[model samples]
Target: MKMKLIDRFGKRLLYGSVLTALSAVLSVYVYAQDGKAGIQEANDKVRGYFSVGCDLMYAVGAILGLIGAVRVYQKWSNGHPDTGSTAAAWFGSCVFLVIVATVLRSFFGIQQ
Candidate 1:
C-alpha cells in the first residue's frame, strides 16, 4: 500500500559496483604496460623505509631501557614488595622491542 523511500531511491550498491569495475579495469591496463623500473623503485623505497624504522626502534629501546633502569633502582632502594615484578616488566618490554627490531631487520634482509 505504501512505497518505501529506500526502494524508490538506493544507489549505494550501484556506486560500489561501478567503482570496483573501474578499479579492476585500471589495474589490468597498468599491468599490461609496466617496466621493471617501477618495481625496482618500489623495492628501494620499501627497503629505505624499513631501515629507518629499525633505527628508530633501536633508539626507542635504548630510551625505554634507561627509564626502566632508573625506576627499578628507585624501587629497590625503597625496598618495595613488588620491586621484582616491576623490574621484570620494564626490562622485558625493552628486550622485546630490541629483539623484534633485530628479527625483522634480518627477516627482511634489509642491509643498512
Candidate 2:
C-alpha cells in the first residue's frame, strides 16, 4: 500500500520529538556538569551575539516542532493528512541544532 500523508507526518513528528527530547536532556546534563562553563567560553571565543540569538531561535523551533507533532497526531486520528509535517520537521531540525549549541555552550563555557 502507498504511504499516507498522515503516516509520513507522524513519522516526521516522532523523529522530531525524539531529537528534541535528546537535545533537551543533553543540554541539562552538560549544564549540571559545568554550570554553563562551556557556554561562557564559547561566547568569549566567538566575540559575538549570534550564539545567544541562535539559542533563542532553536528554542522556538522546538516549540514549533511540538505543535506540529500535535497537529500531525490530530490529523492522523481523524484520518486526515497533516499539511504541516514538512514545516514540523524543519523546525525540529532547528530545535536539534539549538540543543546542540546549548550543550556546546555549556561544555565550552560560551554563555558564562
Candidate 3:
C-alpha cells in the first residue's frame, strides 16, 4: 500500500521532534553537571573534562543537524520519498535540541 504524502510528512515530523527533545534533555543534564562542578578541586579531578566533551558533542550534532535539515528540505520540496527525509529530519532535530539544551544550561549557569 502506498502511503499518502500527509502521512509521510507527519511521520517524519514526529520522529524529528522526538529526537530533538531527547537531545535537549541530554544537553541539559550535561550542562547542569558541569555547572555544578564550576572551577574547583573536584572540577580539576574531573579535569574539566565534560565541558570539552560537551563542546565537541554540540559541534558534531550541529553539523549533523544542518545537514539533515538541508536534506529534509530538499526531499520535501521535490516530493521525494519519506524514508530518507524522515531520517534526516530526525537527526537534525536531535542535534538541534542538544545544542539548544547545551546553550540554555551554559547561559543559565545550570552546569555544576
Name the top TM-score candidate.
1
Estimate, for each residue in 46-94, the C-alpha lDDT of model 2 and write its tens digit.
7576566666767787777777777767777777654466556756676
Model 3 scores a TM of 0.39
Among the numbered candidates, top lDDT falls to 1
Ordering by TM-score: 1, 3, 2
lDDT: the better of candidates 1 and 3: 1
Better of 1 and 2 by TM-score: 1
Model 2 gets an lDDT of 0.73
Off by over 4 Å in 1: 1-39
lDDT of each: 0.89, 0.73, 0.73
Q: Estimate each model's TM-score.
A: 0.67, 0.35, 0.39
lDDT, ranked from best to worst: 1, 3, 2
